[model samples]
Target: MKKSGMSLLEIVISISIAVVIFIPAMNMFSTTGQAVFKTRNFSFANSAARRISQRLMAMPYEDIVEVPLPGIALFDAPAESFFAPFLNTSGTNSGAKNITQADMPEFYSYLVQHDFRYSLSVSNVSFGDGDEIKSVGILITWSENNKNMMYRLYVYVPSL
Candidate 1:
């Protein structure tokens, strides 16, 4: 009599082949997804850093105050004024002087909206004696899989 259906051996062979092919395909898909995510985050972080740098650059050379205002830390500014536009702070008044601990106002908010975490830093560079040009650095950092991602931006401000 002729067999009407696939034999058990044939069925098992087909299932095994399918699994072998499927696992690698699935792995590839997962890897690609992770890579895409990383690329997106990098792009976002870089954009944010550039935006902040542009704002700093726009400031008049003399208006770019590197010195900490009284009651503020080094290279720090009131969060409400600088970051509020980007990060959502509850209080109308930003008493926070530290730029790091302060909640992200503008850029941070954007990152949060996109499910990305980030941090920023600004520093002033001064040569010996009084120099009209000041160097500003903006550092942005984020995280994925408990690993930190970072980007740096530098700008030179001429005296206004």
Candidate 2:
């Protein structure tokens, strides 16, 4: 009677072919996962930067200039979130609402559990013939697989 199963050589050859295909397929999946992770971090940075920028724009020019947040070196990754001090705090000024925990969703919480860090810079700049504007810069940095990633946002707020 004819055998219904493959010989040992046939089985080994088939297994080798499967391995060859599986290795590249697994590599592709790993690469895609990294890309998704990187993209997610970038999206969060963009939204956080926008939220911080808007907060600075809403504040009276004096506040931004006088009470700048602690600065972070662009290349150094801090052990904690730099914006933690500015979050969930009530402002001394009446009708002033500094960013609260609810104001920026997942901002503080994510930083608490993640490597993401941020910094803010407020500096005076001459606009045309007048010096009544301040340039606000927000830097967001994080590490991914031992690689550093950063995002920068700039907005100008006029003295009020």
Clashes of each: 5, 0
Question: All models: lDDT?
Answer: 0.57, 0.65
TM-score, cand. 1: 0.61
Model 2: weakest 10-residue lDDT segment is 73-82
lDDT of 1 by residue, 1-160 (tens): 8879999999999999999999999999999999998888778768866766677767555555543212121122344333434533356545332333344355344454444332333345556576556666555565576776666677767654
- Clash pairs for candidate 2: none
The C-alpha TM-scores of every prediction are 0.61, 0.66
Best by TM-score: 2
| Tens digit per residue, CA lDDT, model 2, 66-160 | 32333443222232233433434455434332233454445545554446666767788665655588887787777667776778998888874
Per-residue lDDT of 5 in model 1: 90
Residue-level lDDT for 76 in candidate 2: 29
